[model samples]
Every structure is written in structure tokens, then in C-alpha cells.
Target: MLRKAFMRVFSAHPIETIAACTGLFMIVLGVALGTQHGWVWFWGQVSAVFGASLATLAVVWTVRMRTTETRVAANIDVLARQLETSISQIHKSVKSGRDEQLPPSVYLAQLEQCIDNLIGVSHELGEITGRPMPYDVIEMMTTRHTLQIEAHLAEGKPAPERRLVTETDSCPSCKQTVEFQIGNQPGDSAKPTCEHCGQRFHAHRSTSGSIFLRLPGASQFTRAVSVSCPVCASKIPANIDQAKQHSEARFCFSCGAKVSIDPVSHACTLISKQDKLAGRFDAAGVFHCEKCGEPASVLTSNINGTFGICRKDDALVVLPAAAAQGSPKTDAA
Candidate 1:
């Protein structure tokens, strides 16, 4: 126990113990010499002790500076390596067109994080050493990385409005390549009839990846049917259920014309707004549009409640049966 305690005290305060021992030895020597030679010998010994203490402190400070410098350099190296690895991974992803692994937004976010780390390391290195930091290489790498990302985004973009895609498909019957119109979105397919053969397919595709299939018989009709506007020749899309319910009206997208279609013939016709409004009820009674002044044969009971009337320009007018009483007659345009 005494040996262990002596070892701990010696390790903890070796410098203080050595100084105390030297001072004690000098005091004993001074006493011996004072009986003979004197005060000059004692003063010289004190000066030597003070110089040794200052030299020991200088050595400790130098060692601390060296240890700190080495650690900072190591940290800078680690950060640089990490940043490089991140950049390489991003470059590989862009090259392989494997951006699905991470979305562009996520990729950009990671790149930003790496750039921040690189910037922090550069700043720390600058603070540690007064030398000019080599951040130009980092700046160049960042610029190049940014350009690559932008290029990938540009490549993913759709064709310009002016540069229309000529959708080429061969007709099943005629086997002739037909180029479709310009405005359809990507993957928009249709069982378009061949202009030469008048052949049509049972299935079709819309811009939003919706499939429209022609029904086999009377009970079920095609969900979405594309028709042309009689007045403007522009395409109009209609849903069969909406046409039957009369709750929703289909109108021409190009011209402000009311459009109706024969489900069997798929014949599109332009009708007056008054005719469209009047078509919303059963034929048991006559009804009139107070705003348009056109009369329609309808069931009074069906229309006695408030009816939502869809007009030519997509405006909805809610009307009650009492508004149908007497109105100025107007002709269809």
C-alpha cells in the first residue's frame, strides 16, 4: 500500500517533487557553505532553479502546438476525402441515368451538405495556418457538379412547344404510318380511326395514363370518349355517365359552343345553350330557360326542384321551375 501511494504521488507531481528536493538540497548545501564560504553560493543556486522551470514550460507549450497542428491537418484530410466520395457517387448516378435511386431534389440536397462541409474544412484550415488555402479546386468541382445536374434536368424535360412530336403509328387495317396531332402529352394513346380505312380500335389512351375502352354492348359505354367540335373541329372529351345523367354538360374546349354526341354513332353536334339547358329534364312537361328564352319539353315534377343548368361557357345556372313561366322567345344560333 505504501509503495502504490508513493508511485501515485510521484507520477502526479514529479516536477514539483523534483523542484522541492533540489531546493532542500540547496538549503542544506547553503548551510554547510555558510559556515564556510557564504551568501553568493546560495543566490547562484536559486537563479539556476528559476531558469530550469521556465525551460520546462517552454518545452510543454511547443509539444502542445505540434499535437494540435497534426490533429487539424488530419481533420481537413478526412473532410476532403468525404467530399470527394460524395461527388463521385453523384457523378456516377448522373452518368448511369439512375436518378430514380434518389430524386433530383434529394441529390441536390446531399450535394449542398457536402459543399458546406468542404467550405467549413477550408475555413478551419485557413484559421489554423496563415497560408493561402487552395479552395479554387473545390470551387471548380462545385461548378462542374452543378452543370452536370442541370444538364440531367434539361435532358429530362419535354420537347419544346415549337418542336412537336410526330407520333407515328401504323394503322392495323391499312398498315400505313399515321402522324398524330402535336398537343397530346406523353403516353397519350388513342384508338384513332385510320383516315384512309376508317378502322378504329376498341381501346384508347388519354394524356393522364387513363384507358378508355369501348363497351361490348348497350349496358356499358366507353367511360371517356373523344369527339371533335362541330364548329371549330377541335377535340372535345366527354364521359358517358355525365351525358346520361344530364347533371354535367360537355362543351367545346376551343369554341364556346354547347356540344352533344350520339353515343352509338359518336356523332358530335353543336347545340344552343337554351337547348342544352332544357335537355336536363324528362320529356313529360315543357320547361323554358328564363335567361335564354328557349323552351324544352320536360317533366315538371323532375324540374320542380332546383336544377343545375350548365351553359355554353361552363358557367352553371341553378334554376327553379317557377322561373320557366313566361319569357321572350329566342332562336338558336
Candidate 2:
């Protein structure tokens, strides 16, 4: 009797075992049966009790449903409808002696968790690539979720083939490739940090990555060449990141001078009080200019020098050739 009782306790999960023990003990006592109860009946009682516990767990977890499952299920419903229609069309074609070919519905599922771990040198790829966790980490996460959906769908037999749909793509942080397989999660957003450069993957890329501006009622967008931020006194650049980190950037929403870029589309437009003037160009061929600046962006002069407009003070000044050997006015242009 003691041995049978011990076996019962050892065979099941802690909680399930406890419930089985209590319920079984009650059954034997209620029936006034002792150890002599037939083995078949005793085992049958235990199985019944275990089955009840399992049903309870199913309701609590509903572990079958997930985001991927919902989407796949919707697709399945649509496919079923299409299949029915196709079958009807095929029957008509067959009666008329046409080809019996039907369009393909490719169904493939990936299970990422099932992927094996790195064996030798590939495991060290993390440090070499400067990634805290290797690409496999994301691949694993995506696969785990994917496997859950695939397991449920596989029972449907020849799954109605269709292109898979997934949320998110390429990791913004690492710029690393995210490749997933059948029954694996696809893409996810990852934020990376560089300890050496203090650069944040999702943050400013150039201290001037993007910038924009808004006006009271302008349907057409325009760039603000150069303007002042009355509040901070810091110049906000037409480029957002540059203005965010550098003092040379200027932004003032008041009097409608602001620089911002559409976060989603990355389109930038500058809003300024007046046309900008002043310009410079580097060897790489990138142009730097203001409206007034835009025209003077390139140094186009005749006779070796010309008078350009005073930049901030709104005055014009002459660009003279090398100070006449003995000239007192000696300012480098």
C-alpha cells in the first residue's frame, strides 16, 4: 500500500500530483475499497483525476493563441473561401474539358528555436562584429514565436501556401542582416549603443541627421536657410542632430523659426524669418549656403575680388585682393 502511494506521488507534477492524491484518496475511501481494488479500476481513477487537472490548465493559459496564430488563422479563412470558389470553377472547366491546373498556395512555416547553437569559431563572431549579442539572438527570438504558430498550423496538413506576414524588419541599431527560417521569427527593432563613440543607434547620427519647420498656413513647404532662436540663443541648424548637439544650431518655435524633420519619412524643411545668405563648399562637393547664402555658396569673383553682402548684420562688404603691399586694411577673406 505504501509503495503504491509513493509511486502516485512521484509520477506527476507537484501541483497535479497533489490534486490527484487528494482526489484519489477520497475515491477509495468513498467506495470503502482497500488496496485489493482491481489495478484497472485504480489506474482508471488516477487517469480521470489527471485529465481534470489538465483541462483546468488549458482554460487558464489558452497557450495555443498568439499574434502569429491570429494572423495565420485569418489568412487560412480567406484561403478556405478561395479554395471553395476555385473548386467550383475547376468542376466547370473539367466538364468543358479544360486543363485541371490550379494556382499554387505555398505554405511554409519556420521554427527559429529549433536552430542549433554555434559550434566553434562562429560563436566568437559577436566580439568581432562589435555586437553585444550575436545576430542569432534576434534570430532566436523571432524563431521562438514562429515555431509556436507553425506547430499549430502543421496539423492542417498541406498548409495553404501564402507569403508570410510579420511585424518589424531590419534592426535599426546594428544595421546587421536579420534572416529567419521556416517556423522562425522574422525581423525586430534593436537599439544598439557604441561604448567607444558614445553614439546611440537610434539617436542622432550626425548631430544634424534631420530637421523640419511649420508655419501658420503654408500648404507648400519651404526650407529655412538661416534664422535665430530667440529663446536659447543657440543657432538651430536645418539639420536636426547637428542643432541638438552643436551650439551653432538655432531653433525658436516663437516667431515661427523651427527646424524639424518628419520622423517617419525623414523629409526636412526649414522655417525662417528671412532668406539666408552665406555659403561654403567642401572638396567632397557638398554645398553649404543660405538663401542669400545659396547664391553666394560658390566663390565666383572677377578681378580677383568682389564685395559680398554683410552676413548677419545685413550689410555688403568688398572682398579685396591681397592688401596692396603697404595697405593698413589687412583682413583675410
Identify the leading candidate in terms of TM-score. Answer: 1
Tens-place lDDT per residue, model 1, 16-81, is 546555655655555555444346666655645654555465456546656786898787676567
* Candidate 1 TM-score, C-alpha based: 0.29
TM-score of each: 0.29, 0.17
Model 2 lDDT-worst window of ten: 102-111
Compute the lDDT for candidate 1. 0.44
Q: Number of backbone collisions per candidate, in order?
A: 1, 39
CA RMSD of each candidate after superposition: 29.9, 27.2
Clashes of 2: 39
